[model samples]
Every structure is written in structure tokens, then in C-alpha cells.
Target: MFYSSSWSKCLICLIFITSGNAECPKPQVEGNFVLTNDALLKNDFPEGTEATFECANGYLKEQGSERITCTSGEWSTLELTCKKKDCGAPRKIAHLTYEFGEEGTLFGASAKAICDKGYQLMGSSYRQCYANGWSGRPRCEVVTCEKPIEIKNGTITEQPDKEFPEYGGVIQYSCDEGYTLIGNKSIECNEDGEYNSVPPECKDGNDIPLKPTTTISTTSITTTTTSTVPPIIRDVDDIPLKPTTTISTTSITTTTTSTVPPIIRVSGRNNGIGEHDTNAATGNAAVVGSVIGTVIVTLIVLFTLYRFYKRKGSYQTGEDPSRKEELLQFKNN
Candidate 1:
């Protein structure tokens, strides 16, 4: 009985040692990490057991082993570490700029795009980072304006052959001869595909009329007369007869004439003088004729006075009736 009891104690001691050596301490896993391909969920694991590690959901393994093993009643050091997954920088877009959210470019992070001036954004404005990469890239496009319509009697100064105009482009206008511009001379294309100002038009210059021409003329005449006594003739018969009276006349004349051209005045209608324009020339000629008649009368009076003075001696002898009658007739003629 003593030997059997000693053997039973030894057996109990051996079993305790074997059980202690078979189990290993629990492995420590970082937060957000899990053991992959492990079937045993108990706190302790058997020696020589192995397991791999992996990060959950949005996390990725970083700078650590992906596997662990149990040995000598203890677990191998848990070197597995996990970090948040990153999608890197956002994709580049033309004419577009991006802003990041608090999560930055990491997994599930959000970013938004803003288009520059004179540009429009296409597709969604916001994008999110995923395991694959950033979501579908948003794009920016330049704004355009429609082609400008042609103006009447005018032409566009620049880029006339282009089918469409870009934002902020300018269009200038000009009018042809005999036409006037009636509105703004230039217009600019806007972001909404429309012009900033209305188009200009050309108006006819002949809408207003001209006035008729008028002419005027004036004439003035002045005449001056003087009387002079002629030399007397006496008869020899001692009878004092009344000296044959002789009369001499001198005349002077002055004439003034003026001619005026037709003056044109602008009014509501167009008018002109046709036949009436000759009247001014006719009046000027009449003034010249009157001046010539006065000069002839003055010359005739001077010649008659000189003849009477020379014949005075012959008339002093005897007066013959027939001769006197003949002399009177000749002087009258």
C-alpha cells in the first residue's frame, strides 16, 4: 500500500506539469486589429499554435508582422500595428480647386471642388476617398457665349468669323457712310451666354430736309440840273430889241446798283429758286441806261451856247425877216 500511494502522487505531479506546459499565455492585439485565420477563441492557446493578424474596416497594417506563434507557455510578441488607410492626394482638375474635410485623404474622407471664374463644374461637386482611390473625378469647363447677331448697316469689329464667343469677349460696331449710329458702339459677352448691352443700329442721314434759297436786288437813281444864261445879240437900227434869249441846261446823274446771290437755309423740306433768280440781273441793267441819257443832254447844251457867242457880230447889222426866220427854223431842228 505504501508503494502504490507513492506512485499515485508521482503520476499526479507529472500530469500537472504536462498541463502547465501545453497552454500558452494570451496574445495582445492592437485596437482596430483582429486575428485572421484563427479558430480558437479561448484566452489561452496551445504551444506551437500560429495565427495571422489583420486590421478592421478602414485600418491597414503598418510596419509589423502579420503573424504570431505560441511557444514555451507564452505567446510571441504581438508586433502587428494598424494605421488608417490613405488614398493619397486628390486628383488634379483643370480650372478647378479642391478643399479637404477634417478627415483629409484618408479612407471615407470627403473633398469638394470649386470652379474658377468664367468656368462651370461638371458632375458631383463632392468626392470621397475609398479603397480603390478617389471617387469619379469632377471636371471644369470654360463658359461660352452665343454668337452675336449682325447689326443693320454695321459690322462687328473683331472675331467676326467665330461661331461662338467666349465669356468677357468684346464686340465693336461701326456704321457705313450716310448712316448714323443710334446706340452703344460696343457690347461684351457675359457668363450667361448673352451680351451685356443691346446691339446698335444705323439710321439714315437724309431724314431731315434743306430749306430753299432766296435772292434780292436794289437800284437807286439821282439827277442834278443847272441853268446858264447865253450871250445876247443887238440890232444896229438903234432899236433896243429884247436880246434873243438863249437857254443852256446842264444835268448830272448818279446811279447805284446792287446784286445779291441766293442764300440757302436748312428747314423741314428741300426747296430752290428757279426762274426768280434772273430778276436780280435785269434790275442792274436799267440803272446803267439812265446814267448814259443824262450825259448826252449835258454835251448838247454846251455846243449851243458857244455858237451863239460867235454869231453875235453878224446879227448886229440889219435884221432880215427871211434870214431870221431861217435861223430860227434851223435852231429848232
Candidate 2:
């Protein structure tokens, strides 16, 4: 009975030894970090063994210990926290600046590029933080315009000495002795790094176009003479006169002649004179038709009022017919 009790004691000791020698499955670090190479190669991590972790690329250890201890056939909790690494600012360029996003210059973040006034962006307008470093080489450059095109028989006066004119630069153009400038007297550089208008042309004085002729048609009872009106009022076409009674043998003769003022204003912009359009004729026809229709309406209203007073007498109950006549007259006028 003593030997049996001793054997039970020995078996209990052996069980404790086996349990103490148990090995942990494995240790795995989260996405932002990784186990050391030596720790990853060997999965047989015995109880009480230690494993160290390393931060992944573009990440940095933020807090807590990177090392963890294995105990009781299971790995101990890792207290290491990781955060994105900062790439810092890139090399500076003239007239260039950067504004960061919510994440700033840390990995995977972006920055916006800005240029000073009178300067333009010449490269990518954004920079990104990548694994290696910031992504692009952004730059800003002074605004400039291409040289004015060559014009035959003309020379550009007050021209800038440089190959490209800067913003707000002014240039005057002049023609040779027998030539004349056919556009604006000067071209100025604008904020867009371009001239306000194309360079003027130099043409021989004899080749300049003559003023255009304008013709207007009209109708009259006895005689009609040509007359001028405000330039804003466009010429109108002949309007046919319909007699009160039909006469089969009568015919009308009409004629028109005019010399339009100089249509080409040297503003280097459209002056309502270049392209041909039917809108002007349409507007004139509408105006003439509206006047004739208003006159006919006035006559009809007067005739209606005369009949209303002569036949019906009172304008229904207490309504005033004179008020309506006054209103109609005001509208006709």
C-alpha cells in the first residue's frame, strides 16, 4: 500500500512536467507590424519564450513595448501600436507652396500646390506621400506670352526686349511708310499669359477696304425722300400699301440708295458689323408690323365704343365705359 501511494505521486509529478514543457502554436503581428524574421521562421515557441516585432514599411512604432512573452502554451498580448511615418516637406521652389490634407505629410497623404500671383503652375499641382518618398516635383513659373507673329510691311513698336512678354506688358505696332495698321493701335498682355488680341496686320494704303453701302426701302402716298435716323435704328424694307378699294390697273415704283458710315471700328473686337445675320431684318419687320397692328386695334376699339354707347347705352350695371376708353387711348399712345 505504501508502494502504490508512491507511484501515484510520481505520475502526478510527470504530468506537471509535461504540461510545463508545452509549446505555443505561433505569434502573429497585425497588418501594420510584423514579427521578426527569426520569430516567424520557428513556430515551436516553447512556454516562456520571447518574440520581438518590427513595424512594416511606411509605418512607425507609436506606443508600448514591441516585445511579447509566450506563456502557458499561448502567446501573451502585444501592446505595440503603429502609426504612419511622415515624409516631411519636399524641396522648395520659387513662388510655390503646399497645403496638406487631414493626414498631413504622413504616408499615403496628399498636399495641394499653390502659386503666387502673376505666376503659373508648371508641373503637377499635387504631391503624394508614398512608401519611398513624396511623389512629384511640382513647380511654379512666371507668366509669359509667345512673341508676336511677324507682319509684312509692319514693325512692332515699344516691344519688350525679352523673347516672351510678361503679364501686363504693353506693345505698340506701327507700319512702314506706305503701309497702314489694320487693327488696334496696341496689344497688351493679359493675366492669361497671352495678348488681349491678335497682332494687327500691315496692309498697303491702297489695299484698304472701302466703306460699305446701305440701302433702305419705304412707301409714301404722294412722294418719298431719303432721310437719316439714329445709327442704332437699322434700315427697313419697303412695306406694301393696300388701298381701301381694289384697283386692277395701278402699280407702284420704289427705289433706295444709301452710304453706310464706317463699320470697321479699330477696337479689335466685334462691333455688330462682321458676320451676316437675319436678326436685324427680323427685328425691323416686327417693329413695323407691331405699329400697324396697334393702329388697327385703336380704330377697332373706337368703333366698338361708338356702337356700345349708341345701341346698348350703359356699360352693364355701374361699370364706367369712359374709364375703359381712357385706358385704351393710353395704351394706343
Candidate 3:
């Protein structure tokens, strides 16, 4: 019984000493960190024990080992350190601006992108910081409009370049000579790829009056004067029943008269009437008078020849011998 009691006491003392020596010193970190794969959250560790350290959110490990060990009742020397994650300054984007959502450019931080006036964004408007770098890189581009349609009888006078017009660009319009404009003289490109107003059109000028035509005609006439025969008087009883007229012995003379009338013609631009001149009337009268005189002389000669022939025939028959002889003697004389 005494031997068993001594052996039990020795075993108890040895177990107590072993338990005291096995306990490890607590480890101190320079910055915010946590043990890797540790579920208990214990501050101490046993001899020959190992652990890995991880930095807190928004922090990164710097110039240190992430692994440590406990040995001989003490913790091994740890050079572990942590610092705030640093994403460099934001990159410059043409025609774009940015705003930070947080004070530092650390993990989980973000920035918002904004396009300048007359500009547009080609990518995401928000950027986020990560362990490697920024989450996205956005770009800015100038807003543009479609090509303007051509105008009839007009031209664009103030276009500066051949490319598509940008937002807020201006185009000036003008009409050709002798044409009138029907709309605005200038138009501006808008964000919707169109102009603010419709383009102008050209119209023809006002009509002019035409001149009238007229025609006129003129005619001329000439005239001449002439003398005419005078009428003679004779006693009524002086002439017997013959067609011939007897003349008195006081320087007897024959006179002829014309009955022909003058011919007149009418002619003008409007078919107007015209009168005969005095010369034409006189010429017609002269011609008619000459013909009348010839007829009178012929009739007188015929009557004389008829009387002579009858007397000669009577004498040849000897019916009135004394009278026929007297007529023959007179004819001979």
C-alpha cells in the first residue's frame, strides 16, 4: 500500500509540470490581422504549433512572413506587417471627369465617371478598387450627329470640316442669285443626330410683264388737171329730120363728149376704202370723147354716100330723065 501511494504521487507531480511547460506565449501583431484557418480565436498556442496571418479588409501584407510558430514556451519572432492598400491615382480620360466615393484609394473603394459637356461615355460610369488594380477603365468620346441632307438651290456656307458634325455644331445656308429662301438661314446639330430646324429651300423670282406689238400702214395719191370742150347752141328749126346736125355758117365746129366713168380701188392695212385722183378722172374722160367724135364723123360720111348712089341708079334707069340728068351734072361739077 505504501509503494502504490508513492508511485501515484510522482505521476501526478510529473503530469502537472508537463502541463505547465507546454503552454505557449501569446503573439502580438503590428497591425490589424487574423489567424488563417483558426476557428477558436485563441491568443495562445502549443509548442511546435504553426499559424498563418491575414491582413484586415482594405489592408495588405508588407515586407513580412505571413506564417509563424510557437516553440519552448515562447512564440517565434514574427516580422509581419500590414499597410493600407493603395490603388494609384485615377487615369485621365479625354473629355471626362471623375469623383471619389471614399477618402482613400483602397480596396472596396469606388469612383464615379462623368462625361463633359458635348461628350459621351463609352464604358461603365463607375470604377472599383481591387487587390490587383481598378475594376474597370472608362473612356470619353465627343458626341456626334449624322450628315446633313443637301438643300435644293442652296449651299452650306459655314461648314468647317468634312467629317460628321459634332453636337452644338452650326451650319449656315444661303440661296443662289435670283432665288428666294423659304426657311431658316442657319441650323445647329443636336444630340439626336439631327438639326434643330429644317433646312431652307430656294424659289424662283417673281414674274415680269411682256411687251405688246402693233402695226400701221400708210398710202399716198397724186392728181392732175385738164381742159374740156364747151357746148354750142343752135336754133331748133335749123335742123331737118336727119340724124346729122346742120351747122350755121358762122365758123361752125364739132364737139365730142365722153360718158365713161372713172374706176376707183380701195386698199389699206384694215381693208379701208380709197378715192380716185383728178388725173385719173381726166384721163378716162379724154378717151371716151375721142371715141364719140370718131362715131359721129363716120355716120355723116355714110349718109352722104347713100344719097349719091341712089341718084346715080335713078339716072341709069331713065325714069326721070331730066331730073337724073340735072343730078348727074351736079355730081360731075
Candidate 4:
């Protein structure tokens, strides 16, 4: 009985040791290796539990555990991790500028983007590291606005000299003459670089009046007169009646005549006697007579004045109001 009891105690001790050893399973030597958070580590399994390692879409198997088993209740190692997809981070750009990561970190499953100086970011700043082993490549672009110069009737006179840095560029407007500009004089570049208002218009000017016309008419009329004459008369003593000899076949004769005088005027004449005269046959005799008479009268007056001067020179010596002569002087002896 004593021997049997000692044997039973030893068996109980062995069973206890076995249970403890199984529970604490030695660090896995051959089960499998696992990658965790970009690192590889051996894991000890727990009682009644099993584990398996798998990479996400953007990850790959490098040197990590794919699966582990619990034979006596001990695990192999911690869950294995998958290396990040080999693809690089999405390209980053700002204001048309770009930059790249110094050391591409794909294991962390994070993607980064950046732009160069003087440029600004346009789209999403971040990206995802995909299971395919790469981050979504982002696009970088430039930003710009619209230009000014909205033309209505006519076109813009000219374009800007230089490219506008801002959104809206500037332009000036003009129109053909006889037409007036109705809208804004100058155009501005909007933030989007578009014109603000519609183009100007061309209008007409004022009007003037005209002159008038007229017409005229003329007419004429005629009249006639008739008369009968009595038989010819004779002196009382010698009065002779119609001759008896010619009474059988008497005949008589009659004649008529008409005359027109030339026209004349009396203007610009020195005297009342002018170009009017009865001498119709002499066309210019009266005019010539008038001119000759005037010349002769002038010569007579000049000769009389000369004679009066000679007489005065021969006799005159003293000054008298009536005589009206300044006599020549003689030297005294």
C-alpha cells in the first residue's frame, strides 16, 4: 500500500509537469514565421488557439508567417504582416510644381504627395497605398482664369501686350464713325479672366433741311379795226362830180403804208438834249453831234482863259478885290 501510494504521487507530479509544459509551449522553432507591422517575429501559440497571417491588397509576402498550428496548445508566432505594394506613392504637385518622397515607405500603407515652390496644390493632397503594391497616383495641374473683351457689335481693337498674371486680361473698344459707343470704355480681366459686360454700340447722328423750287407763265392778245371812207371832195367853184364818161365802168384804187421808229433813251447825258431825234435814217448821228459839241465848248473855255491871262499880264500893276490879279513886279531905277 505504501509503494502504491508513492507511485501514484509520482504520476500526479509528472502529469502536472506535462500540463504546465503544454500550456507554456516552447517558443515555436518550426511552425512558421510572421511579419507584423513591417517587421518579422516568431510567436508562441496559446492553448486551444491557432493563427494565420495575410497581407492586405497593397501588401506582399516577404519572410512572414502564412499560417500556424497548436499541436499541444502552444502557438507558433505573432500574426505575419505583408510588405507594402512595390508601386510608388502618387505623384504630388501644387501650383504646377511637384515633389517626391525621399524614401518611399510602402510598408506603413500610407501615401504622401507634394508640390514644388511657387506652385499650389490643385487636387487631393493624400492617397491610399493599395493592395496592388502601389498608392493611387494623383494628378498635379496649373490654375488660371479667363480673359476680358466681350465684343458686341464690333471687335476689340487690339490684344494685351503681355500675358496677364491674374485671371482677367484687359482690352479697349472702339466703333466706326456716325455711330456712337454706348457701353463701357475699357474692359477688365475677371478672376476667371472673362469680360464683365457686353460690348459697346454704334448709333447715328442728327439731320438737316433742304431748299425749294418754283414755276412761271406768259400770254398775248390781238385786236383789229375797220373803216369806210366817203367819196373824194373838191373845191367849191371847181368841184367836179364823178365823170359821166367813166360812169359805165368806173374803178378806183387805194394804197396803205406802215412805219416803226427805233427805240431811244436819255440816261447819263450832261444836258436835257439827248440821243432822241427824228432822223431815223441816221443811226448814230445824234450821239456823235453831242460828243463833238461838248469837246468844242471845252476848247473855247480854255482859249478864253488864256486870252484873259495875256491881257492881265500886259496892263495889271496893283491888287484890287474886283480885278482879282497879282501883277508882275518891275525893278525901280
Candidate 5:
């Protein structure tokens, strides 16, 4: 029993010596480490030690080496990664939207902003997408076409004021009689969201001419008469039964009748029972008619005589009885 006890004591001593000799020394912890971002450097750790990494709030570790066992008092070559706050690329816009500020940004990216129609985006238009949630609170602003409100003589030619991204455009208008325009006559789009000038005025009016004018009147009179005159004699047998002579004469007279208006002046007598008064209207008409008739009668008589002489051969051949028969028939017809 005493011997067994001594052996046990010896074994205990041997165990303690072996344990002391085999123990791994505390890792040297020599390699420099970066606490910032938990990013590991090229020489971050040594082969014989262990290492741990951590990231700041709003940050995360991309690669972790929280604990590494030491081999030969050195850690295996390793790396730790701390990710900077990652703002995801701007989200896919739900509706078609324009960018007024920087785009394609990172977690801390910021930019001026605006909404589509009707509403506007407020807050420091510029904002960041962060791990701490979207940076600036975005509020919807009301869009309006206020001030100088009415277009005056003109109407809105295009869409009125509306919420839009920075640099969004606008249009205005005016109207006038007898005139028109096709395209937008005036337009403005600025970073400030206000129009630059008012719409233009249309051209003025012009006059045209009228139709023509004139006046006048006229009158005429006609009369007919009958007369007796002989045809030319072609033969002796054509002897006439009566004188082939016409007598005509004319006279003038003025008369005033009670029926005549006082506005017209009248003169002479209207009595019809006396010898033609040199001043009687009837006597005058008769005298003139007689004169004309006498002239015509004289011409007829002369013509007949010449024809008679020609048929009778009174000048050159003395006379021809058969020819006279022919002349007589001619005169009768």
C-alpha cells in the first residue's frame, strides 16, 4: 500500500509537468488590427494568434473571423470585412419619374426631387437612403397654377401648373379674333417652377369696301300718216283717172287749258269754230301736215310725168301704141 501511494504521487507530478510543457501559449495577439469598419488589412492577423471583427451601428461585417484558433502561437492568414452603410441603388421608380438631382446613388446618396402630376415632393428635396431608413422624410406638396390667375384674353394652351421634377417644362396662351396658332406659342420650364413671361397678343382688325350706285330716266314718241300718189306710167294706156299730186301744209299754235297745272305756263285760244287762227294748235297741226303732204305730192307727180314721157317716146321716138298698153298695165298694177 505505501508503494502504491508513492507511485500515484509520482504519476501526479508527471501529469503536471506534461501539462505545463504541452500548454499553448496565449496567442501573441501581435498583428495590428483595424477597429474601424471591421475591415481587415493585408497584415491583419498572424499565423499563431486568434482575431475577432466588429462593425459600427448602421454597418455590418462582410466577412467574419470572430474567433480563430492559434496554431504554433499564430493565427491562420484570414480577413474580416466591415461593410460601409450601403444605400441600395435608387429603387425602381413605380411610375415614370424624372431626376432633378444626382441619381444612381449609394446608401447615403441625396438629390433634389419632385413627384409626377398633382402632387410635389417636399423636404430637403435632397435626401439619402440609409440603413437608418430613408434619410429625409418626403412629404407631398400641392401643385397650383395660382397668381396672375387668368390668362386674360388668352386661354391655357397646354397643361397648367403641375408637380414635376426639377427643370420640368410649362406652357401658356392668348387668343384674338380672326387669328389662330397651331403649336405652343409660349412655353417655359425652369428649375424654379415659375413661368418667365406672359402669352403674346394677337394681331388687330382691318376693314373692307362696299358696293356701287347711280340714276337716270328717258322717253320717246311716234306717229303714222296716209297719202295718195300714182305709180310711174310704163305705157300710154296707163293714163290716170285723177291727179297724182299731193298737197300738204303746216301751222303752229299755243293753247292754255284750265285742266293744266299752274306750275306749267299756258297761252293762246282753244276755240275750234273760227278760221285757223295763226295761233291755234289745230290750225298749226293742219298747216304742218299740209306742207309735208304737198312736198310728197310734188315728188310723186314729177316722177309720174317723167315715166310717162319715157314710155311715150315723146322726145326720141315720138310714140309706141303697144308699149303704151304695157305701160298702162304697169301703172294700173
Candidate 6:
């Protein structure tokens, strides 16, 4: 019994010795930070052991202590505040403007480069903000125009210095004696790097081409139509005919009579007026009829527009309000 008690006491002592405060897992917290040299080297963090941190790249400390302690096998909440570092405003470039994006001048920000008028960008237009400074060096180059093409039988008497031509530069041309200039004598280099007008041409005064005298002739065709000059018959029997119309809204019907001019057929001999002459007369009559129809339609439209304006004016004008009341009363009745 005494030996049994001694064994039980020894077991109790062993268990107590084995169970001293357990070492905490590696300490960690939520934020953009890195552990100190001591904390990173050691894998084990006993309870009450403290660890230190520093802000990561591109970030600077804002507030709060960088140190934290492990309590009861757990890391304390992160109290360190780290904010993005500033790269400062970019340097001013000649003829260059910038468009800073959100979070301006801070890390990871960007600026779009814009060149002024008569200039163009030469490098990457986008510059990014970094932990050290901006990413690339962008520049603006002035716009220029190429030399004008040579004109035939003409000479470019006046132009900008042979080196290069910029915006608003003009090139003047002249023709040789006995030759005349065709188009504008001068071409200008506008804001965009291009000639504003086509170059002029030089043409000899005696070298002009003319059209043929009988160029109005129709193509080769043999006609058998024998009718000679379709007679212009104007009488009461051939009065202008119209179709019938009926209005359902007013229960009104209008009936009209149509009279077709007689078709006079002649022998199938080649008369002075054959198919060509007959067709030409018909075409003339059609053109006259189209002109008359257009005039009549225009008059009708003008009358309709006038009547609409008169009706609208009657409503808008302050004349005879009592008359409108009387009309309303008549309707009700």
C-alpha cells in the first residue's frame, strides 16, 4: 500500500512537469507588415513573448505601436496603422499636360499625358506612380509637315525653309510662261500635319480640248412608226378627265367622266416624225404636265398651311371670347 501511494505521487509529478504553459504558434496579425528579425527567426512564441513589425514596401506608418504580445496562445489584435507613401507631384514638361487618376500622387497612381495643340506625344503617355518615383519619362514633340509634291510644268517659287515646315506654313507655286495655273496657287500646312489643298497644275494656253459639235446625237436606231407630228388636238371633246371620288364621313359621292384621245394609226412608213419624234413629243408633254402638277400641289399645300394658321390664330387671339361660349352652347344643344 505504501509503494502504491509512492507510484501515484510520482505519476502526478510527471504530468505536472509535462504541462507547463504551452508555447504559442507563430504570432501573426492582419495588416500590411513584416515581423522583426527575432520574431521571424524563431518559430515558437511562448505566452507573454512580444513581437515587433514594420510597414511593407510602398507604405509608411501612420499611428499605433508596432509591438504586440502573445497572450494565452493567441496574438493580440494588430494596432499598427500603415498608409500608402507619397511620390509627390510630377515635374512639368514643356507642351505637356497631365490627367492624374484617383489617389493622386500616392503609390500605384497613374497620370495620362496630353500634348498641347500643334504638338504630339513621343513616348508612353501613361506614367505610373511608384514607391521611389514615377515609372517612365514621356515627352512631347512639335508637329511638322513634309515637303509638297512637285507640280508639272510649275515651280514651287516660295515655301518655308527647306529643313521642315510647321503649322501655318504656306507653299506658293508658279507656272512657266505660256502656261496657266489650274487650281489655287498656294497650299498651307494646317494644325494637322497635312497640305490643306491640292497642288495647282500648269496647262498650255493653246492645248485646250473641245467637245464635238454633234455630241447631242442619239445612238443608231431604225424606227418603223409612221406617225408624223402627233396632232395637238385641244377641244371640248378632249377636256381634262378625272376619276370619281366618294366621302363616307359626309355620305357624299362625286362621279366624273373620262375621255381618252383617239389613237390615230398611220401606214408603217418612215415619216419625218417616226418613233423618235413621237417619243420626244410625248416626253415634252410629260415634262409640261409634271411642272403643272407640281405648281398645283404647291398651291394646295400653301392653302392648307394658311387655313391651319388662321384656325390656330383664332384660338390664340383674345378676340370675342363670348363667341366661343356661344359655339359651345350650340354644340350642347
Clashes of each: 0, 0, 0, 23, 27, 0
Each candidate's lDDT (Cα)?
A: 0.71, 0.71, 0.67, 0.47, 0.47, 0.71
On residues 63-116, what C-alpha lDDT tens digit does candidate 2 reach at each position? 888888877877888888899989998778888999999998899999999998
Please write out the lDDT profile of model 6 over residues 1-333, one tens digit for every residue: 999999999999998865666567887666688887888998778878889898988999999999888786777877899999898888999999999988898999999999998888999989988888999989988788887889988899989885578877889999877677889999988768988898999886545443322212222222121212222332353322232333222121222222223233322222222122223455455555655665565566557655754654321234476875676677669
| Best of the two (4, 6) by TM-score | 6
* Least well predicted 10-residue stretch by lDDT in candidate 6: 221-230
Q: Could you give candidate 3's per-residue lDDT for residues 1-333 as a string of tens digits?
A: 999999999999999888876856556656677766672377768777776788877688887887787777777766778877888768886788778875557777888899887788888998888877788879987777778767887888887485789988988988777666788998888766678898888765442222322222222222222222222332353211213334322122344434433444433323344555445466565666666665676566557656754654421222465865675667669
lDDT order of candidates, top first: 2, 6, 1, 3, 5, 4
Candidate 6, residue 230: Cα displacement in angstroms equals 30
What are the runs in model 3 whose C-alpha is more than 4 Å off? 1-14, 23-32, 36-44, 48-52, 61-83, 102-104, 157-163, 207-333
Q: Estimate the overall C-alpha local distance difference test score of candidate 4.
A: 0.47
Q: Is candidate 4 or candidate 5 better by TM-score?
A: 4
**Residue pairs clashing, model 6:** none
What number of backbone clashes does candidate 4 have, counting pairs of residues 3 or more apart or in separate chains?
23
Output the TM-score of candidate 5.
0.29
| Per-model C-alpha RMSD | 21.8, 21.5, 30.8, 34.8, 23.9, 25.6
Candidate 5 global lDDT? 0.47
**Stretches of model 6 off by over 4 angstroms after superposition:** 1-21, 176-180, 203-333
Model 4, 74-151: lDDT tens digits are: 565555654555555444343332233543545444544565432345556655555455444555433333454355
**Candidate 2 C-alpha error for residue 80, in Å:** 1.6
| Per-residue accuracy of model 1 over 1-333 as CA lDDT, tens digit each | 999999999999999889867866666666878776463466557788776778877788787887777787767876777788999887677789989989989999989989988788899999888877888778988777777879887787775355777777888898776566788988887777678989988766555344555443434444444444434444553333555556654454555545454544322213332232445555556656655665666666557757865665543446677877776677669
Candidate 3 positional error at 140, Å: 1.4
Per-candidate TM equals 0.49, 0.52, 0.47, 0.30, 0.29, 0.52
